[model samples]
Target: AVFLTAFMPDCDGPRTRVIEEVPVSDWMDSVVDEEHAPPSVFLGPEFVRRKLYQLTSEEDYTLCQSLARVSSYYVADQQQRPPFSAARYGAVTKVYVIAKQDLAMVEEYQRQMIAGIPVAEVREMADADHMAMLSAPEELAGHLADIANNYT
Candidate 1:
């Protein structure tokens, strides 16, 4: 399993949600409706460019902008759910890919998750952002290929 600058949870008890270390002002550009049940979040273009696709080319970000959608970040469902079984989830070896320029999750928070959930290997890309597939596809693919070759 590979976690590419993604939130990783342990196979233990409750699944702790990743709290955004960024300030409210940082997300002010994005649309967030707290009044809605469970809340709705729409990652605006400017916010996405700065936070998610900072390392990507402007052309690329613009090209993919139309595909973006409004979504909700509800961890309550995950929190209420039971943890994954060690016999299943923990049985698999996990590899984590750290994206240094990821403003969304940030590098420090990524390291913390890795520390919490032990992984077989850890890889990092200094040039990658939150969307490493877009920002650093070649590097991300290289890491994935290496992981697959070694792990599988």
Candidate 2:
């Protein structure tokens, strides 16, 4: 299971919510540009069709149909409580794979949500952006394996 604690894409939430207090167009541009690269590389026509089919197959198309609808509601939702508070698992270990560069902001938000999580390990990679998992998958995977070994 993954607990994502960050600004939500506008497409998933309601409007009139402003998380970063930034202009709507700027945030939209950033999110789209960030995801566009990988899709261009990996998401060919077939992949696009499959993804569209999957979305249409889902019953929640009312929500899905409003694709790219920007909203800051997710931030308010996250701010109200911790990301993992509603998780199904109890007493299960969790690894927070955060970007090294985002440590400051992520930690600040985490502190507001919960304290004393006993970070089992922290892997800091150099020159990695917010999307470190995509930017440095091998390095991230290696770190994850190392963490898993420690538990075993």
Candidate 3:
């Protein structure tokens, strides 16, 4: 099984639909400045700090900033594309690993997504935030390994 850690699956819904549903406050900066190239999504450092990660150290915040990118419209368009039927992907063993402490994609929404699309298994890490890869790497890795042992 391909264990998804703090991942929102495609089958849950379209980006447009999900965005509409989620209470995402002023998260995007559509403005194009000299420093920020045209047609880019800008998520400021403060937002990233408060909304994206459970930073245990200063380095985690720095990592968040360094990893930030101008989310491409093409990718957004692709995400906006119609969702695949559950039947199409039902054959594959999907596992959802929920990050309980995530502020960006909160536990309720994660549960809703999981409920939207039935998965083979669901694992959870109570300490992890949206950036579980950084916040709770060992636990995430352990879950992946466990899932792999069962599926692969």
| lDDT by candidate, in order shown | 0.82, 0.39, 0.67
User: Which residue pairs collide, candidate 1?
Assistant: none
- Over 1-152, each residue of candidate 3 has an lDDT whose tens digit, in order, gives 45444444555565455554654364533332333333355676766777676554578788667877766433355565776566765556788888888777778888887786668899999898777788888998898889989887
In candidate 2, how many Å is residue 90 off? Answer: 4.4
What residue pairs clash in candidate 3, if any at all?
A: none
Q: Who wins the TM-score comparison? A: 1
Native-to-model Cα distance after best TM-score fit, residue 4 in candidate 2, in Å: 8.4
Give the residue spans of candidate 3 off by over 4 A.
1-16, 26-39, 73-76
> Whole-model lDDT, candidate 1?
0.82
Worst 10 residues of 1 by lDDT: 15-24
Could you give candidate 2's per-residue lDDT for residues 23-120 as a string of tens digits?
Answer: 43422222322243232112222322232223232333334444534333344344444334323333455555544444323445433322334334
Which RMSD does model 2 reach against the true structure? 12.9
Q: Poorest 10 consecutive residues of model 2 by lDDT?
A: 37-46
Clash count in backbone of candidate 2: 2
